[model samples]
Target: MATRCLRYGSLAFLVAQDTALVLLMRYSRSHATGEMYLASTAVCCMEVLKLCVCVGMLYAGEARGSISGLVNVFRREFLEKPSEVLRLAVPSFLYLLQNNLLYFALSNLRATPYKVTYNLKILTSALFSVTMLGQKLSKRKWLSLIALFVGVTVVQSDNHKSDSDAPHPETGLGYQTLGFLAVVAAAFTSGFCGVYQQKILQAGKTNMWVRNAQMGLTSVCLGVVSTIVKDRQAIQERGFFQGYTRLVWTVIIIQAVGGLNVAFILKYADNILKGFAAAFSTVASCVLEMAIMHFRPTATFLLGGALINVAAYCYNTPGRKDGNKLPR
Candidate 1:
């Protein structure tokens, strides 16, 4: 458990750092005409780094003869049971959608309101769990959900300051309202993906390594295809070697390491838990951002963040039904 906690803590740290760097760098490039191309290249670099890290982690697991012991688990299990492969891949694809869409939305908005509105994800995730996964939610979980709503409301109120006075985009009510909905949609899809991923993981004595390796391959293929479809020239222009600075490349590498741990956690645990992890990781990132802002956090911001953390913890507690059901 100590190791697990440490691992998660480190993952959170990396995600927080990566997000901060991405947001800040994107902000610097916001006025540039090639924003989309820049963003795509940046995202691709991060994905490639993630692919490498996943491979390394899989190898490490194989060396320990644990989760990756079945290096040939693909041939033995998936080749013989193609349906199983499809089952896992299906949820992972959905997860990929949820992730990319969320990032897209985030890139479009500034970090403050984005942070405040993102908490709505927890509510959507629970709804997806209850409706699609047929998972039961304890009364405590419901209360926590309510707390999350209130916390988000408070944070939103804090985020309403005039953007004219600020350096970044002011995030008006209309944009935030729309961003809120987009984030909600992303969260719902992500919640469903989580429940389904848990189902796939629990289906049989499957080798987690092979499952991840295939997922890495799938992500690279699908990501490359999608990126090409969106802007082929943009991708090629931002050659792998020329697209990023040394510091940015370092950030991408660290983000990949963090992402690998997150993927492993996803394989073994519930998806709602992963959502909570992401949400809390956002909070951690927000705190880090606040510190970087070099201004004192208002009482409202601090209290609201605390509430968000509480809600996340309540949702993450063991034996608490995450409100998702799996096929028995």
Candidate 2:
């Protein structure tokens, strides 16, 4: 019963965190203050927060006497088998790349369109799970993925129509193409990184917090390099954390918490569950926007949400021995 409660609690946390992340990103990008943020810097800030959280967890565990003698376990492990840490940390850099690309894509696209396009990552993740993790999916799962794809495409088309109705509609084909490519790349990286991280988690008994710290450290270093290469001029002129209002800080905090939560979810669950949580979060975001932002939901959005939920059910239900049937 306790385990079940934990599972449900974690799922709820993931959904809430994901919804908060979407809303914060939308707010930051559309702020009227003309505040522009560098993607690399944002990534760095999130990684720093994750790193701090991981360290805090380690200290807390020590205080509880759960990891009494393992105070320097991370350092000892690295010194003993640096390659192992690198094996996990290097693949994690893909997450940083994906996250930065997502920021770029969101900057170019509206929130609804971005979420619709990003749902493609679910299919991408399933593909990676089959190829990289050597997992097999039933025909029902495949059909569910197809349904999800169709539903998201409908949402995307609806969003495009809405975009066209806007006064300052973005008509630049080049910009649209670039945004699409960025989203696609981000989806691919998200899939690859998720599967790779899962492989790492299964390879050893390393604590999830320890792995988070290693990944966070590696990501922070990469983020620094990326910031220097990509946003050095902007940083020099405006300084780090410039134009960071309370809303911006809220976004940063939400991003950090979400990032840390993902590591725990990945450790305790699989990519499929994570994907479903994201799908639910997308729907929740639409509802929240309707209530808070006064955005009216279109017919397509409602239908798409229903279809996506059905797809999630289809994917999660067990297949029967006689045929590709959903669970009873």
| Candidate closest to the true structure, highest TM-score | 2
- Candidate 1 lDDT, 1-328, residue by residue in tens: 7656654665466456546644554343333233232444455666666766555655566546454454554456546866655666665566556556554555454565565556676687677768866678878888889998898778756754333223323222225455556666776666666556556655655566566666666666666666667667755765534434555566456555655665556555555665575676565556665576433457887788789878888766744445433211
TM-score of 1: 0.71
Q: 136, model 2: CA deviation in Å? A: 1.3
TM-score of 2: 0.87
TM-score of each: 0.71, 0.87
lDDT of 2: 0.73
RMSD in Å for all candidates: 5.6, 3.8
lDDT of each: 0.59, 0.73
Inter-residue clash pairs, candidate 1: 135-323, 135-324
> Which stretches in model 2 have alpha-carbon errors above 4 Å?
62-71, 159-177, 322-328
At residue 120, what lDDT does model 1 achieve?
Answer: 72
